[model samples]
Structures are given as C-alpha cells and as structure tokens.
Target: MKRSSPANLGAEKGQKQPTMEEDKVRSLFNSKIWDPEFQDTLKNEIAMSKPYNWGTIRDLIDDDLLRKVRKEIETEIHFTNKETDIYKVNQSGDLANLSGLDWNDLSRLPSLCRLREILYSEVYRDVISHVSGAGTLSGSKMDMSINTYTKGCHLLTHDDVIGSRRVSFILYLPEPGKRWKDHYGGGLRLFPSIVANVPHSDHSAKLVPQFNQIAFFKVQPGFSFHDVEEVHVNKHRLSIQGWYHIPQEGEKGYIPGEEAEWVKTNTSTLAQLESNVLQDYEFPKNERNILPYHQIRHFDELLAAQTSEHEATESSVDLSLLSEGELKYLAEFISPHHLTSAGIHKLQSQFVTKSQLQIDDFLNDTKSEVLKKLIKTDELQKECPYESVNVEAPWKTALPPHKWRYLYIDGKSHENFQTEQDILNSLNNEEMPNYNLLSKTLDPVKNNTETELISVATFLESTAFKKFLALVTLLSPLSEQVLIRRFRPGKDFTLATQINKNDLLERVKGFVEAVLEGTLCLTPTDGWESGEVGGYELYMDNQDDDDEANTDIKDAAVYRSDDTGDSVLINKPPSWNSFNLVLRDESVLQFVKYVSWAAKSSRWDITAQWDVKTVDDDSENDAE
Candidate 1:
C-alpha cells in the first residue's frame, strides 16, 4: 500500500488531529461496551432505531474553506458517469461527472479530504470493529472518489454488501449556504428488515446531512438496505462518498497480506451471488436448468436439433409452481399501483376454481402483469421446491438465474428493470423522440436499406427490448449494460438475429456443424444423481421437513448432475443469450392478450407452443 505525506492530508489538518478528549472517545469506540444496559440502549436507540439520525463530526470544516474547495472543484473538476462491472454510466439518472475531476483542483475542499482520512484512519477502524465485530474488512481496494449525485439523482434500496465489503460511509457536501433540506431530497434512506431475509418499508432511517458531517455504518448483509432519495431541488447535492476497505499494510486497517488472501478466497463469484438471489424466486436448487457457459461450443450445440436429457431421480421440493393463493399473497407485498378491481375479479374466477377444467385456460395466459405477479410473488418466496416435467425431447430446467443476464437491444444491454426508463430518456434526448415510429430518409436504394436497418434499430429500441434489458440487468455478475449500434446490410442482419437467439435449437445445430468439421469440444459422461462435488449439481439440505424421517431427508443427498465423467471439468450455468421469445412482434401481441387474460385467471401454468426451427429440419419442430 502507498502512503500520502502529512502535508498532502489537506486543509482540515487541524480537525483530523485528535485532541486528548477526542482520544478518550476514540478509545470508547474501540472497546466492546456490550453490557446489558448499553446493549438495550443501543437496541432501543440504534439497533431497532427507526429512521436513524447519527452523523459524525458535523462541522468539521468551516464554510469559507468549503466554498474555496467547491470553486476549485467547479472549475477544475470533470465528472463523468461512474462505471462499474455491475452498473453502467446511466444517461438519464446521471448527468454530472466529477469522478475524473482532478484531486489537485479539490485542495480547498478540506472537509472532503478530512473525511477521507478519518474514514481510512485508525478512528474508523476502531468504530467499525466495535459496531460489527466482524473481524476486519478485506478484499477489493477502494481507490476512487465517486462524486456524481445531483438533483433527481437517486439509488434504489439495495444492500451494499457485495462480496467482502467492510464498511459503508458517506460524507456530505451540499452547497455552503442552504441547509441540505430533506425536501431538497437526496437524503440517505435505510430500511428495517421484517426478518433477516425480508425487509419492510413501514419504517425508515433517513440521513440528511449538513456541511462536513459524515455518516458511517457497517456493511450488514441482507440488512443495511439503503437508497438515495432523488434530489428534488434544482441544486446539486455534492458529497465525497467512499469506503474504508479492509486492512492493507501501512494503512489504518492493514493486516499482513490480508487483503490479497481474502481476494483469493473468491467468497462468491458474481454469477453465484446472482444465482442465490434468483433462487429466492421459486427456482428449485437442484432441478433448476443449469445451462452451459457462453462458449462457442455451447453456441454450436444450441444451433443443432438435439435435446438435453440426463438420467436422474426427480426432486420432491413442493415449490409454488403456480399457486393463485401465492399470487394473491405477493400482490399485497410489492403490489403495482395500477391494480384494478377488474384484475382482482379476474384472478378470483380462475384461482378459486383450482379445478382441472380451467387448467388449459390457466396455462394459456403468459402476459406481463400475470408473469410479473407470478414471478414477483415467487421471488418473495424464499425456497424453490423440485419440479417434474413430462414434456418430450431434451429435458432441462429453466432456472431463472441461468436464463437471465445482461441482454442487449439496439446497442445497449439492460441488467435491471429500473434501467428502462433511463434507456428511453437517453434515446429521446440523444436521437428519437418516440419509438413507435421511425425517421424516414429519401434515397430510393439507400432509403430502402436504411428503412430496414432503422426497423431493426426500432425493434431493438422497442419497449419490449427495454423491458427485457431491465429483466436481465438483475440477473447477476454481468449486471453492467452496454450498447453498440451497427447496421448490417444483409449479412449483418442475419448474424444479429442469430446472435440474439443463443438457445438450444441454435446451439445444437452450431455444435453439430462444428463436430462435422472436427471442432467439437465434447466431454461425454453419464449424468450423476447429485453431480460430483465440483460438477454442476444441486446440494440441498431439507429445509421444510419437520418429521424425524424428514430430518434424515434434510441430510439425504439431492443432486442433479449433467455429466458423470472421471475427467474434471468446469460447469457453467446457462445464459439467455439467445432465448428471447418475447422480442418477436407476434410474441409481443400474444403477450399482451395473455396478460389481459391472466389478470382475470390468476392461473400459473400458462403454457404456449411454438415451432423451434432446427438446423437440419427447416420445418418447425413442436413440443410442450
């Protein structure tokens, strides 16, 4: 680790310097004051505390000093949207960019620099150690200062507890004269959990800061649900926000090679973490469709006309596959504002029937509201029971995580549902006004070509694609969205369509062709029951069983394996690279009708059949 000189510590040197009194308070922060009285107070005052209001060293920096810093930042700073592996530079949500702003111009911002030092200081280490007692934070180094939230800027509620985050802290830097008003918005909001895994919005913790005040909290996993209220006022809510990473030598929390060791541990890959989240939504552990990696070989297999069939005993986990009761329960929890009595009446008719007579009607509607209600409710349900299918051909599970990922439309990939509004705004501001129509040009030959290309672009720009993008954004480690617009006269169009649909039919054909050309990456094996320790398999501990025999069932082995070979190979879960049926114009029309029907039916098994075009068989192949 590198060290900055004392002189480089900046303008707030006086405040950063601890006095004897400050030292005593620091000692208290370091101590384990876990007595019953203290514990109860903490619980009442802080633990179960609603809308917490704790801030640190509020007036650590003087106004004149801050003004100078703001001037320097305003002139010399050049903020761009912050980019990350999970989130891209949001065009609509993000406008100002000071991340690339040179720190040299920020010298006058004494409060900013001072906050950083204290955060990376011994004081912070002691405070966190006392609060969390989670040993010391470790892993990814926090190197940059992201100062990019302005009016209307907000971040939705999510735990900052990504792999190995030690502590989360924010420093305030609103304009000098005006108070950082709550109405001006952009205040930090924290949510209280109904249970360890479930959170309710009934109560909240808001942090509206004054100049130089800093707020810190340990990164509590599944808890610590926080978001930035959208700045309502016209002014920018400037803040020097950062994190105090786990110990690094020469730094306050430094431990010997501790950071590197933790990084090597690979607590959980981004993909695995995503899998865990999706698992929360009705996807059973073992039976979930675990697709292959996004490799060329798998791509080829998808293009062939073969199905995947592995011999293993079916799982017995009674997941809420399609229960109308479960759907009603979820409607209460995250219910859409547009709910209507008509929709409820519709749902009641089908849900109450539960009779096999309406099974066909139930499986015929796969509309947005229906899917949304079903999936969202399923998401609220923590455990996914095993499901069995009697369909023909290659049999596999369609695990949510395995299928959803960053999906690209036009040139952009959407990873979360929240991003669609931003995407539409970007398109309107940058190019098109409305996506319903296309901009026409006047060159007979060129015009025709451009018109077709624009249609493709328009299709990519469609609301469906935007919704698809949002759906995939929440899929996992590949959370970042990216877009690259290109016009392919004839050849480009074919390839784009093919690439957009990277599913079994396409992959199988591609694989078969490659095999004939002697480029097959084949590793054949008899599928194992519970896959080998490292292979793609589900290891489930019985969670719901209450009886003693069920307790044994909990320990009983439940595994679903893809291959049973002596050769050790890595197994990659599936990707929805080319599994988009919703993108088709016909699909969209049918989808709307299905949703309308679903609002009334509230039934889950809304199945539809489409002919999958195979490589050898140009004719459509059908199976349910």
Candidate 2:
C-alpha cells in the first residue's frame, strides 16, 4: 500500500484536511515527521552531527503496532547468543527470512511482518535518504536482524562500512511503559575520531533510547564509530538493526559500479588492523621495545654458559643457583616460599608438564600488605578517573579503543595524545625503554598507590626477576614489556587477540618461538572469583571452532554460551595476590574480560611478556 507524500498532506489551514492515503501514511510513522518544518530540522541535525552524520527520532513507530511487534518477537523469535572479540549479544536470525519461517513462526509473527514491510517501504526510505542526504536506497535487498541486549551484553566500536550498505539504523523496543535512563547502561555511544579510522579512547556523546525511538546514520567509513554500552541491569533491550543498501539494478536512482567503487574505497578495517599495518595510528602501539644491547647479550651469554655447564638440564631447573644477593632482591617482591629450591622444583615440574602455573601469595608479606592496603584505601578515598581528560600525570589511556581500553603505566615520561599531531609526534620520536628514569621519578617512599605500582613495574623489569623466570620456564628471554595496568570498574578491557606470529618469529631467530606471559593480580575486591562479574584473564586455542552451531564464524574457538569448556584453557578472576604464568605460541588468544560496573574496584595487575627461545638440544613439544 503506497502512502501519500508530505506535499499531499500539506493542506492549507482551514482548507482540506490530509487525504485518506496521507492519513494512513501519517498514522504508521510518527505524524510529526511528515511536517515540512520537522523534515527540515532533521536534515540540519544530520548535517551537523558530530563523530558522523546521524540523527534520532522519538516515537518513530506507532506505539500500538510496535508493542504488538515486540510481543510477537518475545513469543516467536529464538534468539541465539552471539559473542566475539568485540561484542556479546543475543541475536535473532535475519528478519528478512520472515517469509521462509515455519508454520508456527509465521502464524505467530503477523505484527512483526507488518512492521518490517512498513520499515522498508518506499515512503519511509525516502524520508531517511533525504534527511541523511544518502542519495538512494533499495527496497528489494532488505538486510536486518533483531538483537536483545540483556544484562552483560555489549557491542564495541565499529564503523558500519560493509558492502553496499548506504545507511544504518536501529529501532529501539524496550519495555513499552518503562523509560530507559542514562544510568541503566546500554546507551548508544558515539566516538570522535583522532584521525580517519582512529576513534578516541572515550565516547563523546550517548543516547539512552526509549520505546519506539530510532537512531540512524549515513554509513561514513572511517568516521562512524559507535558502540552499545554493556547493559548492567536485568532488563531486555530489544532493537531492530538494519542497513539501507545502495540502489540495486532496476531500482530507482540505481547507478552501475557505485557499490563496487564504495566497496573498494572502504575495505574492512578489521583485516588491516589484525595485520597491524596501521600501527602508527594505534595508541600504546603493540610494539615491544627491546631491552638494551648489554642486557640482551647478558641473557644470551647466560643461556650459552648454562647449556655448556649442563646446568638447568632437561630434567629440572634449580632456583637455588641464584646468588644470595639475587635472592635478596627478589625477596622484596616475591615470597621467599616461591624462591626456595622445593618451590622451584615443583613449579618447574608442573610447567614442564602443563606449560602453565598460577601461584597464590606470589608476593612477600611486606609487599603484599603494602600494596593491598594502599589499593583498598585508594578505592575508598580517591575517585577513579572516568575520562581521559581527568586521567592525571604518569598514566595514559590505551587507545584507539577498537582493540582495547585501559589505564597503564609504561614507565615513560607520559604525554596525552589529545590530537592527531600529538600521536604523530610520538610516532616520529619513538624511544626505547628506560627504567632508570622510572626509578628516579616515582619515589618508593611516597606511600601512593600509583607510585607503588610504577615501582613494581620497574622491579618486574629487573635482571633479578628475569633470572627466576628463566629458571622456571627454562626459556632465555630475548626482549620484554612490563606494564602496570588498571582495568577500571565498568570502563576497561582488552578484546581477544593473538600474539603477532610474524613479529615474534622475527624476534626469535630459528629454534622454537614462544612468549612467556605473566599476570600479577592485585585487585582488592571479593566477588570476582566466578568470572561471572567480569575481570577474568582468559586464554583460548585460536584454532578451535565453536562447532556448527555458529557457522558464520570461520576461525572460531570452541565456546559455551558462558565461556567454559576445553577451549578456554585458563580462566582466572580478579584476586587479591596471585601470579599466573604461561608460555604460549601464536595459536593462543588471550584477553582480560571487561570489568563490570558493579565490581567493587578496578582490576589492578602487572602484566609481563617476554619473547624467548628453547634450548638447542631439548626436544620437548609445546604443552598447550
């Protein structure tokens, strides 16, 4: 049924009222959008929208019809749990397949079917295209799916630049009578770009949707970056997400080769990002700065001499070989129990078998008490910085945010990356690690949490720590990165990512390549042990699959809806004082889950990584 145009609805005052066809058109969508003045306002709003060209309208769908549609969705749809490195949500199979539904589904979803038709109708498409200035849209190729964001569901930042999609939209359908508030979470957040393809660390604006509201934007590649904030409460957030495709053949305004040109111009950013070809644009670049030449040579010489002397043989490694002075330096940070010969033997044996270990009470009593006390007090007394602008001296936010977002102290003279120029300057003037400056600046006597953490990061970089590491893992360190990271409640995380195989292989010359990873968890909270409230360290076999249940993901890891089973080899929740060590190859993917807003405090930890090599004669296979 064709709806009358706005010109037909524009009858002069006291002349004739809207025609019957016009009334039908006005009744489906909110009547206000048919007004010339309102359309003009919407056009201007889209033109001036920040981060990208976008606009939203409240009460877009007729309330009664939408409520019926929501009920049909609730009753008829089978929502599958969809998860990935960047998002987690319950998703329905494509609504475009509504006609192909089985008898029960088809009979139960009449209102949903109507809603879809009205949405893709020529009348509605015209309003969207004209307002957003997207030239044309196809009615034939309807691409849409339903998503429900329950508690813990989230969608990370991405510019919706897929093939032929000219405009993107989401029509919200929360509980009909309830108001979705700002504090409810699940807000649609827009991020301003630091440069093309580089979104800032934090969102610039957010929209808390109400029932029958619709938010949309022109698909502007490299500029339209947005995310759905994780829903924190137990409320169902239902939405219809769809893209208006560029006109297809025989459609009005169709242009040959337009889509192909657009596709070539806007290649998937994920492919380029995974390869790290755009490293310069990435903040806190994943590049691991090598230790000084003398230090590298020292480890090389130590490994060669140890091999020649038949020390730390294939059977076991002896930590007791450490000089008294070496033991004393480590005693300040690591528990003496972990330094004993028995401790080293047990740990080595376990690592030799499993290639991994998680040790509790990893720190000495003095250091543990000091750090725990300081962290707890700081949480109670000090406010955590929620904004990059509020992030004080010494710490920097990990960015462009598609990859990760957390606060870290890299033991460098920190500068805020406020603009494209700031980041460019950093790339132009890169420097190597300097623990000397870190020691001179952050005083251990300050009794401050930040300073204490920085001190720990520096200590972890020391030769003494590496000696103990070499003893247990039986791999000689070639290069390393030690970072003191704070995964703030509600705001920090690392998306799942594999170690760059090419980079690690290049660093480790010929014999087997591996990276030794260690996590020292110092979180002072309590309710995170179950990994239910987030803040967990997870490692998975990247080569595995989620099975045929999810065929869309080609290179998937086997996963249960709750993230259990053999795929997840290790899952450690936020803890008081513990250390986890693992030697992993490029096939392993690792990430710290995003901490929930309900958590008591930030998930504080010191993360350490080292590129290493196997001894020439040993033939033990990888234990992963």
Per-residue lDDT of 175-235 in model 1, one digit per residue for the tens?
7767877677677777665433233332256778776666667655445656565555567
Candidate 2: misplaced stretches above 4 Å? Answer: 1-27, 80-84, 93-99, 102-105, 292-316, 443-447, 501-511, 544-566, 617-624
Clashes of each: 46, 0
Question: Please, what are the lDDT tens digits per residue for candidate 2 over residues 1-624?
Answer: 000000010111122111225446567888888788999999998899887789999999888999999988888777776564566678675443553544244466777766766776778889998899988887766667788998888877777766677888989999999899877799999999998878888899899988999999998877888889999889999998877878877779889998779877776555557677667887666656655556555555555544554454554444445778988999999988888877876777677689998889998999999899999998898888888878866678988777788998776667677799988888877676565676567656543787777678878888888877777766767678888888887788887777764353464443346678899999998999876568898888766433433121111111224334557778888898898999888888788887777888899999988877664433222111
lDDT of each: 0.32, 0.74
TM-score of each: 0.39, 0.87
For model 1, the superposed segments whose C-alpha errors exceed 4 Å read 1-44, 47-57, 60-68, 81-115, 123-144, 162-164, 193-203, 250-273, 282-612, 615-624
Best by TM-score: 2
Give the best candidate by lDDT. 2
Alpha-carbon RMSD of each model = 22.9, 7.6
> Which whole-number lDDT from 0 to 100 does residue 88 have in model 1?
15
- Model 1, residue 451: C-alpha shift (Å): 37
User: What TM-score does model 1 achieve against the real structure?
Assistant: 0.39
lDDT at position 59, candidate 2: 90
